[model samples]
Target: MMDWRTKLLDPTPHARRDYASLATPVYRGSTVLFDDQKAVTDDWRQADNGYSYGLYGTPTALELAARIAGIEDARETFIVPGGQAAIALIYLSYCPAGSHALVPYSAYGPNKAMAEGLMRGLNVEVESYDPLIGAGISDLIRDNTTLIWCESPGSVTMEIQDVPAIVKAAHAREVSVALDNTYAAGVMFDAFAQGVDVSMQALTKFVGGHSDLLLGSVSARDDVAYAKLGPIYQQLGLAVSPDDCSLALRGLQTLAVRLDALEKATLQVARWLAEQSLVDTVLHPALNTCPGHEIWSRDFSGSTSVFSFIFSETVTAEQVVEFINALTIFKIGMSWGGVNSLAVVYPELERPGVDFGGRIVRLNIGLENPDDLVNDLRQSLGSI
Candidate 1:
């Protein structure tokens, strides 16, 4: 008989029966068991072959990846540590040293930071263009230009891009176009249909609707894009926790209902703010006042939680802070896409020829009663 300690250490321990559940099991593992020596491998493409190592992903992570790919109609999807990691992976994969890339000035602040910091340090020139540059992007492309990034209804400033035009221009130059589809939750916008080569999302927001997890997805539009991203993904070891994947999976189930309710509530709040005396503009893409509202209407199927609004020039920056602080229902926070409302003032927010002067307030509407939220905003505006 085997020694008691040896038995305890047995890797082949078995349970009586596996529970048949509708939910995907949280597969926490690092080392995968192989049937034979020849079967041993360390491949990231588990969906195509078989599980090789946990550093790529366990079954839980792959399920999330597959589902995201299915929803986005992507050729394949890579689950990474966070949205920023996804961005980094894509950049490193596409932009070799001496290569040039284009990113919108209105992209997520961190993306621009990476372009200015890391990509610059690596000798890759990432140029910033107007989000609405459209087909005019052709004028910016050069022989070394390898990538173009589009972030629709861009971060905080909320400029919806002319993705189709940008894609057409980039393809004309044989350059790849990538999109930050986080605001669309990977579903509201058809990235593949719009000719995007890769689409990425911060699943932490809408997909992990409770704000309880941090995850991101990079979906390749075809075999070519997938082949380009896969090796770099493996090299970076972009492993995510199965537990976080589980939370994202749960978030996906309620995503539709959450998005619908958020749209209605957010529109109500945004429209009300538009009619107010102190408000200069509402930056929600659904509103005609937004910079690329027509493009948003044409390209996007829907909008999700977050958007921005600017206070009139008469309002002081300090007054904006006071108003934000006075809000009871809308909590002061940075990230959005959760069960609770969030508000923050971007005092130093900059665009080419525009200065918000800290008067730009971005809001992430939650699943709260619109009436209560409006009342909260009404009371806070009065405080200012």
Candidate 2:
């Protein structure tokens, strides 16, 4: 009874919606139809109830969020566009206008920039404190101190922080603690157990296991934190593509094995670099040279592949460039956590507490063979 056009135009069509697969299905759409008008009164911010809006999350996004929450051992998680966006979400949610926040001096460069720029513009006072301050941070706390930002093992310089001490101090003043656990990837460090109010990570790094995608996640400790952060996250309009979420979910499947390999490979390279004539000191939390090595040893269960080394004073910037450029396997790049090895030189590190008087280069050990990577480094050093 129906023509071809009528058949095509009919909105009431059915397909088997339930099918078992090895991976979570990616559901992409902007509009989610409600079965009844009463559902309109339901909150779209809560992803647990049912389908809401695409911007809030698709099934793929929610799947990734659930996995990240499980990894973090937190109650709820939110996925954002990138790692930087996660930081912004926390800052916006907690650090209200005219409030104060304390950030580690050795935090990621962009986080520092955010504090100095947007946070400042919002009439918030962002104070930079030494990562090793520990309980001494209590001195900086004020009546308006709303949040404390911490980054362990200083992403670039590898200065481990006294997280428990910082947390105790912050909680004493009723301030919430937000930690950047990207380096640990929620495995090495237990953020929730350590009393962190909010745990955030760049899924682009170890979670994605490849440099191809950029995604970030924020996990809230309990219902109160979740309720507070959810609205702000929605207002920020942070949305990640379903494809990126699916890729991140896939990356989670092998995260354990990949991280183990990277850890073993990185420590081997770091030890070798420490003994090299061109190297002054290696900045790795696993090594004694790092500022808070003991703290890291006590708090963290494992180390990551990314670490930095400082060249001896005798090694000039030009020589450093020559050495880095001479490398065959390691590509010159910025971000890490990919299958391919990466190397970068930070000529002028503005970190105050720590000092790397000479050229500083950060290496991200990938899935490459340790022997081959060492050989490449030896050859590069010979060239310099």
- Pick by lDDT: which candidate is best? 1
Clash counts per candidate, in order, are: 2, 0
Clashing pairs in 2: none
**Predicted model with the maximum TM-score:** 1
How many angstroms is residue 53 displaced in model 2 relative to the true structure, after the best TM-score fit? 0.8
User: lDDT of each model, Cα atoms only?
Assistant: 0.94, 0.91
User: Please, what are the lDDT tens digits per residue for candidate 1 over residues 363-383?
Assistant: 999999999999999999999
lDDT of 2 by residue, 303-348 (tens): 9889999999998988988989999999999998878899999877
Looking at candidate 2, the ten consecutive residues that score lowest on lDDT are 40-49
Clashing pairs in 1: 153-160, 347-358
lDDT of 2: 0.91
List TM-score per model, in order.
0.99, 0.97
Would you give me the overall lDDT of model 1? 0.94
